[model samples]
Target: MQTTKKSSGWHLRDVIMLTLIAIFFGFIFWIWAFAYDAVAATPLKPFANDITLGAWIMAGPLAGYLLRKAGASFLGEFLAAFAEMIIGSQWGVSTLLSGLIQGIGGELGFALTGYKKWNSFSLVLSTLTSTIVTFGYDLYASGYTSYSLGMLITLFIIRFLSIGFFGGVLVAAITKLIDKSGILNR
Candidate 1:
C-alpha cells in the first residue's frame, strides 16, 4: 500500500528528509549551473540552452511528493537554490530569486490540487508551471527579451519540455524508487 501524510506541520523526519533532498538537488543544480554556462558558451546557446532549465526545478516536486505537506515544494526548492548559491552559481545572488520564484510556481500546482495529487499528471502540471514562471523571469533577467520572437518562442518550448521531463517525470521516478526502498514510508 502507498503511504501519505495528512499532517499539518513539519516533523523532524520531514526536516531531515527535506534537507537531504535540498542538499542533493542543490549540488545537482550547482553542477548544472556550470554545465549551463559551458553550453551557453557554444552556438547551441541560441536555441537549445533553455532545455537545461528543467534540471533546476527538480527538488520542488521531489520534496513535495516525499513530504506530502504544504510548502514542501517551496522550501525544498528554496534551500536547494540556497545551496547552489553557497556553491557559487554563475548567476550570483539572482539564483536565490530564481529558486524562490520557480519553487513558488511549483508549489502552485500542488496547492491547486489541495495537496492531494501526487501523480504523474500533477507533477507534469507542476513542472510546466515552473517552466513558465522561470522562463518569464529569464526573459528579463537573461536578456532573452533581446532575442528574436522566434527564438524566444523556441526557448520557451525547450524549457517547458525540459522541466516537464526532469522536474516532473524524472523526479517522480526517483521518488517512486525511494518509496520502494521502504525508507521514508512516504
Candidate 2:
C-alpha cells in the first residue's frame, strides 16, 4: 500500500500541475487587464473591470477542486501573480499586492470548508468570497467608493455576474474536466 506523506501535503507532480494552472491565470489576467483599459470608454465599458472578478471565480475554485487542498488556491494565485510580475505586468508592483489579497479571498471559501471537501456549491462560495474582496479592493484601490450609488449598484451587478458565471459555472466545468482526467486520483 502506497502511503501519502504527512509533512508534504503535495507531490512534485501536483506542484507541476498547479504551477501550469497559475501561469495560465497570469496570462489570462494580463490580457484581460489590457482589454479593459482599451475599451472602458466604449459601449463595452461594463465589461471592463468586471472580468477581473470573473477571472478569480474561474481560477480560485478550480484550483481548489484540482488539488483538493486548503492552500492550493492561494498558492496557485500567488504563483500566477509572481509570473505576471516576472513577465512585466503593466500594473507594476501593485499587481503583487492585488494577487495576494485576491488569492486570500478565493482561499477563504475552501478554508471555510476546512479544506475537507469541495463541490460546485463550494466553488460558488469561493467565487463570492473573491468578488467581495476584489470589490472592496476596487473601492479603495480603484476609488469606486467615491462613485454614486447607481454606479456602485452597477459594479455590484457586474461582480455578481463575474462570480456566478465564472466561479460557479466555469470553475464547475473545469473541475469536472480535471476529475474526468483521473490525474488527481489518489
Candidate 3:
C-alpha cells in the first residue's frame, strides 16, 4: 500500500492549474459582483434579482473538482475575491471576508468526503454544504431574518439552484473540458 502525503500530492502542475483557474474565476467573480451591485442599486433591483443562489453554490464544487484538493475551493474563492479587490470592488475588504467564509463552506463539503473522491455526487454535496453555510452567513450579515419565511425559502431554493447548477454542473463540465485538454492528466 502506497501512502501519499497530503500536500505532497500537489505538484507544480497542480499549483499552476489551480492558480490559473482561480484567476479566471476571480476575474469573473469581480465582474459579476460589480454588475450585481450596480443592478441592486437600481430601482429595477427587485425585478433584477434574477441570478439565483445555485449559481454561487456551483463555484465551490466546480473549483474543488477541478483542482481535486481540499484547499482548492478555498484558494479559488480567495483568489476570486482578491481579483475583485484588484478590480476595484466597492465592498473592499468585505468581499474578501465573504469569499473566505463562502469558500470554507464549499471546501467543507469535499473535506467531509476525505478528499479521496471527485464526482457529480460530491459536487452536489458540496453545493448543499455551501448553501447552508453561506445562507446562514447572509442571515446574520445581511439581517435577512427580518424577511418573511416565504421569501427566505424562496431565496434558499434559488440559492440551491445556483450552487447546484453553477458550482456542481458547471464545475463538472469545466473539469471535463480540462481533462479533455490533458492539462491535469493525473
Candidate 4:
C-alpha cells in the first residue's frame, strides 16, 4: 500500500527532497543576484528590474510539488535563502527575510487549497500569490510606494509576468521533467 505523506506530515524522503531542491536553488539565487545587479546598472533598469523578480520565487513551488505538503514550499524557500546568504548574497540578511515572505506567498496558494490540491491551477495561483506578497513587501521595504503610481503599476505588471513565466511556467516544466524520471513514483 502506498502511504500518503501529506497526512503524515513530512517524511525523511520529503525532507531530503526539499533540501536538495532548496540547495540547488540557493546557488541559482546567488548567481541571479549578480545578474539582477548587472541589469539594475543598465539603462533598462527602470523597465527591467521587475522582469527579474521571478527568479527569486521558484524554490517554493518546486519544493512543494516534489514534497506535496503544507510547509514544504516554505521550508524549501527559507533554506534556499539561507543558502544564498551563506553564499554571500549582496542583500545579506534581507535575502533571508525575502525568502521567508516569498515562501509564505508560495505557501498561500497551497493553503488556499487546504493542502489537498497540487495541480497546474495551484501552480498559477502560487505564482500570483508570490508576486503579490513579494511586490507588496517591496513597496514598503524597498520604498516602491514613493514612486509614481504609473511606475508602480508598470512594476506590478512586469513582476507578475516574470513570476508567472519564470516561477510558474518554468518551475512547472522542471517539475514535469523531474516527474518523468519516476523518482516520485519510486
- What are the RMSD figures for all models against the true structure? 4.5, 4.4, 4.3, 4.0
- Consecutive 10-residue window with the lowest summed lDDT within model 1: 1-10
On lDDT, the candidate that comes out on top is 4
List runs of model 2 lying over 4 Å from the truth: 1-7, 41-47
Question: After aligning candidate 3 to the native by TM-score, how far in Å is the CA of 38 from where it should be?
Answer: 5.8
Ranking by TM-score: 4, 1, 2, 3
Residues 55-162 of candidate 3 have per-residue lDDT tens digits of 434455666777676687777776666666777776788778877777888888888889987887777778888888888898877677888999788777877776
In angstroms, the error of model 4 at 173 is 0.7
Please provide, for model 2 over 1-186, each residue's C-alpha lDDT reduced to its tens digit, 9 standing for 90 to 100: 021234388888888998898888888878877766776778777657775557644565677787787678877777788777778888898878877877888889888878776886677678778888888888889888788989888888888787788778877877778788876786
* Residues 1-186 of candidate 1: C-alpha lDDT, one tens digit per residue: 011254447678778878887988888888787788788788887654576888988898888888778889888998899888888887789889988988888998888889888888779779877987888888888788899888788788888888888987788779889878998763
lDDT for every model? 0.82, 0.76, 0.71, 0.85
Which ranges of candidate 1 are over 4 A from the true structure? 1-8
Clash count (model 4, backbone only): 0
Candidate 4 deviant stretches above 4 angstroms? 1-8
How do all models score by TM-score? 0.89, 0.86, 0.82, 0.92
Ranking by lDDT: 4, 1, 2, 3
Best by TM-score: 4
* Model 3 CA deviation exceeding 4 Å by range: 1-13, 38-59
Going through the candidates in the order shown, the clash numbers are 0, 0, 15, 0
Can you give the lDDT of residue 163 in candidate 3?
71
Q: Model 4: clashing residue pairs?
A: none
lDDT computed for candidate 1: 0.82
